[model samples]
Target chain A: MATVEELKLRIRELENELIKSKQKQSDAEHHLRPKIDKMSAEVVDSNPYSRLMALKRMGIVQDYELLLFDYDKVELANMNRLFFQPHQAGLSKVEAAEHTLRNINPDVAFETHNYNITTMDNFTHFMNRISHGGLEEGKPVDLVLSCVDNFEARMAINTACNELGQIWMESGVSENAVSGHIQLIIPGETACFACAPPLVVAANIDEKTLKRDGVCAASLPTTMGVVAGLLVQNVLKYLLGFGTVSYYLGYNAMQDFFPSMAMKANPQCDDRHCRRQQDEYKKKEVERPKQEVVQEEEEVVHEDNEWGIELVSEVSEAELQDASGPVPDLPEGITVAYTIPEKDGASGETVEETDQSLEELMAQMRKM
Target chain B: MATVEELKLRIRELENELIKSKQKQSDAEHHLRPKIDKMSAEVVDSNPYSRLMALKRMGIVQDYELLLFDYDKVELANMNRLFFQPHQAGLSKVEAAEHTLRNINPDVAFETHNYNITTMDNFTHFMNRISHGGLEEGKPVDLVLSCVDNFEARMAINTACNELGQIWMESGVSENAVSGHIQLIIPGETACFACAPPLVVAANIDEKTLKRDGVCAASLPTTMGVVAGLLVQNVLKYLLGFGTVSYYLGYNAMQDFFPSMAMKANPQCDDRHCRRQQDEYKKKEVERPKQEVVQEEEEVVHEDNEWGIELVSEVSEAELQDASGPVPDLPEGITVAYTIPEKDGASGETVEETDQSLEELMAQMRKM
Candidate 1:
């Protein structure tokens, strides 16, 4: 048998060989791929942004830009989903995401923030960025997307958006990892996060108290991936103005059920900023110009018909308008579900009015 | 001013420095992530598979294993989507996927096939592997997932699965990249791909003729990611026996619509193997034991009530059975939609039977 010292020396030699082989492999990979300075739509194997640029060619989007924010570092647990790699465990999530995204599409400019948005200083900076961070400086951003997990982070976003009168979308996956949802928040036009607090918050319970030591919430890659995909798809639709942007969409994996509904903002919302935004939105609605309706002459399919058969539309104009027209303040396909009830019975408005309207809509849907 | 020769020398030196810096960065990354020998369920920052393994503890999946199949090499264009990286451009897709998947969860065993399955020789090999490639040797795989893009490859999988009586799921994205669908096939029990050929195939058009030179199909990362998410979610549900497995689910991103339906196997399928499997399934169904129903006594809630008021169920037993009972040869939630029309009009069966049932189901859905 070899001596312990000899064995130790042999182990060191093997370790050096392994390291050398790894270096060789890394060098080969680096040599194979060179960074491109611009995004190209060329139909070639080497154009990374070919498919994405095709979206612009197809007239699905005007232009796309990217920005990232995160207060946490990348962890190995994030690998179960997508994006982060095992080698990036010690890097900040925003830095890691920016690096990977830059490599994928170098044409897009990136700005990453690695601070907690809930903090007073960061929240002010976040609001400033949202107000004047467009492609053209001093202009507000087109939209905001919230993918934060905790209630506090969501509330922080809600408060900022409400104060700024910004449109945003929020997404979340259930703790059990079997369901998820994405909701659009149009400041005063739709229900903000503060307008309808979750049951835990409404009950005045500390959200932190729900956590237990040595126990973690369950998660799955499939649910998170689906939620992310849906959220991005919605973002594309809203930006491109090509599809019906959903107000609220939910997914239930257990039964493959998807429940969608729109909720109206509460008139008596607790947040003063939300109430102020609602008043401004109402003022804007009064000043908005009415759309003009144009009528087209009906085409005569058969100029000379022996039978003289006449064709008429089965759908009436009022019904057609109902199907396609925007509601009083909301967009088409978005109907008010209900408003949050006021606490302390301060407002004695009959709940029956909202309840009856929701029932009527559900009844109509059932009769469809 | 420097001479041309001196400038060239300076450029060469900078290039050398660039290469050295990249090498150092790669080495640091490699050292940070050591290969894990086993998957752990402990929720920690370092456990990559912690979230995935939680499924077992949550009683969703009993156990999971992975196998991959692909013939194409990775291209930079694929980086717009998830999974593949820029460094993996020249690598075979199956090999790259196996490398990434292995790093995510080292406990799972993987076997990758990197050849076209449509060829006669390779088809035989593929069938053989599917028949005896389970964790337990000599047994078939639990399920086969077909993510192939071409009609020829899909048909190849359809044929093999039909001949072997294996279960599989087929997924696809639309050519325009705005829609996608997932369909589950249980050999003879459901509609095989050959049983209902697409319109182009039914018209006997050469699929290759549809392609044009210097033009490529449109694709979006969001649509593809969503399709993949749905496909994997369905796979998890099928393998884990947790959720209701859908027979056919369609997604239209333009309208955010998800249309689901089920189709029964055709009696006059083009593939002879499918007919044989159908016969085998029918015989097996006859041989299978029927489940015995257990009746429970209703508990009295108002035992001491002098008013003699008693509560009764509003839903009848027949309605309950209709809602939950499995169809004769299909699972619950799977209803026969329509059969493919016979080319020669050999079968005298009326198309109205299938059409009326589908209409009734639609009517019921509208009423809900």
Candidate 2:
């Protein structure tokens, strides 16, 4: 049995130990909320990853809270399009978006890079340094997304992705803020940015130079949001392999037109890396196993011939030939042939059919 | 000559009054910083509306801060799609969004109405009360935006707008969350919401009932942003009379397709107010001057055909006749028809051509 004074001293020491333990538990929770386990879709305030986890619960993404976003600074204009708030007005966009994202789901591993993506050195450093863990295991970062505004930045991203033989997507909105486009680049498999330069570059005009003294390009949060949403949607599709991913998608908001087309990697691309990628793509095509072709049978379920009447097709060969020419008398406020001008010394059209064939062949192999 | 003690007392009293005045100034600033002057695009932290003011500088909007927005409660799931921040996790959506928007541009008028818009009385009272200022002399509110989620709210808004002859815009995202649409409604001039009910509403299914147990709709901030952008862009066009605003614009993210169509006020609409508007439109058309029709001349600029051959038109009467039927064998992943299923007792099709004629006549009158 201990004396009264000695027992009182032990009780005080135990209480101090309990206080230290409680502080340790709190510190652990503050630092490592989701570090211990996978994201949970619990609809509780304590669950930081509830929103992203909801994506999994909704069956949209297989693995929730796993996206790497690179944002630099949040301007006042960006507030309309992004989750950046007023209190975070002057903060780095990466930090602000990351803070919001973490609150959405802390399980998502978000790494930020605020360097200018337009510089070659910076681009290389970013691609290699950030993707060091994945690159070591032969797969580059699952996908690289280029949402940069300027041509130089796009070209830089294009070059880096080509050099690494990585898959990536590019998105942009027009200066008028009424249109936008998103395109996929599978290194050697698809057209690189240098393959067919945008009309702005082909017209020999710098996008930044187009801005007048006190006039900036019109931008809408709506266009940016749509583009971003589409970009992410395609990303999810590519990652989860569910829907048909558009190779190139364009948006004309004024008319609400979405035009899609696939581009072949230009053999005489300005970028040497693009040409090398094309060559590698060709070599791989030759090395792959013979692809099984699934013939689309023109089967008429109504084989009984109930009507006994042969109906001629709506469009004749002559009509089809006539339709091949440019359409005249477009409705008011509508324009046609808004295309990227061909590059000097480049073939007008070639290799697009071959690219499609190659894609089909890859699909067949995947099915096997 | 006053005594030294009296002078000292006066000085102390003045000092106390000055302190109170300083406190009042601070409080005034906290509550109303934008009530003083027009929105300024000054690039300063103190200026809350710089980004929106940039729109005026960019020549997009004549007045950057004059628009009104209504927001309600904010939720954790809303963080994925809106400007919800970490600190605003538990706050009402209206308060959080308003706090951020005011920070973006304090000049923009933001009014909050947290009650359910689907409630007929609440919607009517809300709309009437809010627009009393603008409706006093005949002109209704500049515009009303229905960003509510369900069909009941849409019908309620439509009824109120029709009753007041107010112009409004409707925006909605599809259940799959991959598509959305925005439409401009000019009350009497354009199609009312009841003219062509949405497929879901036409099916007579409750939107809230569509949700399964523990399952919520998948949404992206990108889509909502895009829709909002388009809505604001159209509002600017309608207010400033610059760009050609689409009456209806649909967005399909999966295929990056935008399908546009024009709907006219149905003469036999379920809503009696819509039928009255149509009758009024027809009466106005009769009262207006005859529109000058521009006949398309078949003038061949070239005396001789370039290829020494005649090119026959493709769309013959037979093809046109056949084209009206249901098209089979649409490209994979492309749905040919996305018709809004007709409601009970609704006509299959009627009065759309007349509506177009009315619109054309109105355009002609405006030109004259």
Candidate 3:
């Protein structure tokens, strides 16, 4: 048996060796990884291949089998006011939206329309009819989706969605129904105009662009393409759950923000849209929303008899208590809030309390 | 121009109409995505971009940066047990390591051999000597890194690493010099195994090969290669802090015997080899009679919150009430433990209890 002293000595020797070894790998990866990303872009810009790298780099990408549908010719959809026919009279956005519709694939598809007269009640009736049609035809429909443009039409989007989401959650497909309602709703998901995050899109604000476009400024092609593209991206990844999708994405004309959003895993902001819809949804029965059905991904941090993640405030406090020396780990149950406040207008939205607890905030959404 | 209620109505209409549209998008994604992925894989496999894309996709084909520091190169390092060489040596792993090394645009590359032998005394002495060398040579090294394996190393052959991870984070390099009797170790910005979760590599039992090579059961190159690959991946990524380095990837392998073994991350587990012999330096370390680190990549669930990456049974019943749910995010004073049973023969790894209130758990990680 070697002495403890010898073991210590040898371990030291290895440490130095390991450090030097790292230098070489470091250089290669530093230069190469970025190049890989660039190459991926190159492929996207020019190559025929289109599947991008996995979002999280978690290795395997197992796709969940989904209930695919098609409604290209039958269920075509677009807001006539915005439709641009680049390929038609001149490729317009609505045209692009149509193109997106035509090209999208899966065995089953739904047909939307070119004409519209509006009201949440009118839309709800139409949806109830079509949904019944699909159910009557004995077709399996797991989700209902819509992709639209900036600020102008998303409230109606949410209202129509709230009823559908509620029905999907409550009345459900009486016989065989899907469990959740995915918004692919873009702006609605990003929060209200005031609640938009700076990261999502950097809008260029010249006095001209600002005065001319105001909140409804013209969106750029690449940015708009990303929005439409992300719509496709979101739709493909979220429902069957083969890939991961971040909660929100935004494009700002004033702040010059486009695709400038970040991922907020499980946020608890009682924003106007979320709050308003929840209240609208729950007139009869309002119970605590099922926050968690199961504790899926959690680890118990038990350091120094403390439990959980390191709080930003407690490091020094705990260190002071243990003079014996090096603090091992941080305390648990501490998480930082990452809600970037959106554009809450002056005297505009409902109770904007900064001090709402998570439960309170969640309760607000549940009211819908 | 639409009225607010009209806008809301339109929003509701759009929302309702968009529902099926969104589902169509989802279904389309399912059908088209796989084809796109297949096409993309074909492009990568064919390697279209001549040098750039090929270099990006294939990833410096076999280049091991650690190869440059030969035995005689690093003064303080133990030449005998170099960090790692490809098992089938005289083969190109060294050339691979070296080729990747030469391309780097680093300001300087300091080569060394066998630097990461883990031990207290040796760590102390070498640190002192290096500091002295820097003072005398008039060239100071800013960081002292002990880079171990990345995610690739912890991957098992065909089935395992799909979820199980690889990588070890023990003593991180910080500006603060952590010193003890014989170990005056200073950590730099580089995150130690303590910061990132420890990579757990387990011996995979090859049933097919077991029947053929019978008794010679453990020949899992794919698994070992996965661990080795991810190790290099992290080493490279860590050196250049441009990308994300996941905090945890866990594994707890299922054994064929009455009892099962766990290959997991622990705050205290360092990647000092379990010891054996080879060259001159190996004489002192190798003859030292080692403790077995682990031989199989078992099953492990990694938790990303501040709570511990792996779970443990150390917390009692009263503790379980708080422990059962997701542990809080780790605070500075807490140590998270994977709540599982002890392994085959390992014993007495001290755990620090967390002091987070149960309320935090029920709200966050616990979500119960």
Candidate 4:
């Protein structure tokens, strides 16, 4: 047996170890474990994904799912507009977004990738990887949203999406950060990013050279939040097929001015892929089938039918049997009931009828 | 002393207790601790408040501060547009906002209050509490932002602000959740919330009653974020006096339309306080001082300022003293360099001849 003093020392050591272990576990609970396992519409405080999952409950989405980027580290500024926790400060932007969204609706499958989109190889690889799932089998992505800041990244995303024939939406905020714009590109259908040179490119100025040394551009959570909301709203509209999707929308927050316009594909486009896609679109349109309207005559038409019912042809015995046997499928709540002989007259009928056949039948019955 | 078995049992108990303690510590670190002591502009992943604090570095806000609510639990649904952590679920909405904002910008002074705004007594008490600090030395609240979802709450806030002669802004989203609006209200200078009843309230339908038993009004984080951003933006503009603060702006996300309009306060307004405010505004306008334009004639006007040397006024002794003794401010890069001329010629004569006389004396000297 050990001495009592030795036992006390052992106990103290165990207590210290226990405290560290408990701290670690608590940290894990706070930062690691997801809060929810699935989307719920309980409208309770515990439901983190309530608003997003509400889309499905509200009949806006058939099955709502999210695919977001996992590359950029979320800046402290992004916290104002996005659901990023302070403990997640050092995490990648995509990871932070995923972590936040997972807690909201853990059922939402997330795919994250980190890479500089400005490079051609990286852009192409990313596009191909998403378009054709690499390691695991997955469906092609429906829409590509470019929320990049610089012009180079925008060009790369635009180029990659154009090459893959993917539908993509581009979002950007002005340097002053008070204004923002969102544009939808349908490859061969709408204006490609390359179709018309960007404003800076049009002026033949290198966008990269415009940045002055030691000066950072201003950004606001409000501007970014608004832009992100607009982008997501457009995504829902496109996927759920509800409202009209804006082709090009610009927001000037200072003046609360929103300007919208549609842009046609440029005939003198620089990109070969865009030009090729436009040609294919034109060719497909020419070969597309035209639809024709056809009219047919039926057994009976209510007099209230537009233009009044016209008799095109005589009804056959089979057609008459089909119509009368099924009660002619009269409008809702209009039923025809026959009266029994014991009844003096048809009980439910309010109309006065003059029928010679009925009078003759009654006379024969009287003679019998 | 103690038995060996007892010591073993004690050790086991310590281990279990250690685990629990560690878990709690971890939870506190993740959910409770304020991440920042002061807002810093250091652009690093670890600094969560860097971006928000950068607003000061960017010269937008003089001293960035925040005032938020401290009551009502945050639901999962709010995660769509806000920085809500799952750990913050049980915390009141105001507390969650405070916690999150505190982590983002610990330097921002926070004043919190909890109360039902719809009740007149509660509103008055809360307003008084904030206006006259109950916990700390009193400082008047600058502007009140009415972000309440219902009409009664909006009316109460408007009334309170109007009574205090406070400037306030109101924000709301539509039932469909795809549209939103923000308006600025200057108690006496602009339309109060009650000056013209909101469209929903004017219809005499209770918004709460419109919600079905098992269904909630659909909400989108995007819509909320956009609205929040616009609201904050208007607040910043009102506070910092940089951009045009929108008086009434409405956003139609479906059509990507933003409509703006202005309305004057109704002369026959229902709110007695509003009517009183309008009258005070009229009285103040009458007593306001008028501005007058005063032009000084001491400075010599340059002849080439227009028409390239058309005669304007003769050069005076005072003008000569002002020009030679003190530097005459030139438009851009034309510096005045006087010549001593080896003490043989007048030093400032070249500029003098152009003006005309010591008119002829100046002209001869200028020619020399």
Off by over 4 Å in 4: A1-66, A74-82, A133-138, A202-206, A289-368, B1-59, B133-137, B199-211, B290-368
Using TM-score as the measure, name the better of candidate 3 and candidate 4: 4
Rate residue B193 of model 4 by lDDT.
71
Compose the digit string of candidate 2's lDDT tens values, residues B41-154.
665444545444544533434333332334355555565654665456656667776677676556556555556665656666666654663433433557788786667778
Kindly provide the TM-score of model 3 when superposed on the true structure, using C-alpha atoms. Answer: 0.25
Candidate 2 TM-score, true structure as reference: 0.66
Q: What DockQ, on C-alphas, does every prediction get? A: 0.18, 0.09, 0.01, 0.13
Question: Top DockQ: which candidate number?
Answer: 1
User: How accurate locally is residue A247 in candidate 3, as Cα lDDT from 0 to 100?
Assistant: 35
Q: Give residue A154's lDDT in candidate 2 (0 to 100).
A: 82
Prediction-by-prediction clash tally: 0, 7, 150, 21
Give the winner by DockQ: 1 or 4: 1
Candidate 3 lDDT over residue span A1-368, tens digit each: 54555555554555554455455434323322111112131212111112122111212223222222122221111111122211132233333444443332122233434333145555665455434545335432444444432222333444444444422211100000001112233222223222321111112122232222111111122223323333433443343233234333332211111121221111332244454444443432234244431221111000121211122221233333331232224232222111112333421112321234334433332332
> Number of the top candidate by lDDT?
1
* Candidate 4, A60-117: lDDT as tens digits: 4434455565457755555565466556666787887776667655556776776676
Q: Model 3 chain A — which ten-residue stretch has the worst lDDT?
A: A169-178
Report the lDDT tens digits of candidate 4 across residue range B247-361. Answer: 6667766555565544455555567888788889878766655441111111111111111111111233353343334333422111111111222233221121121211232
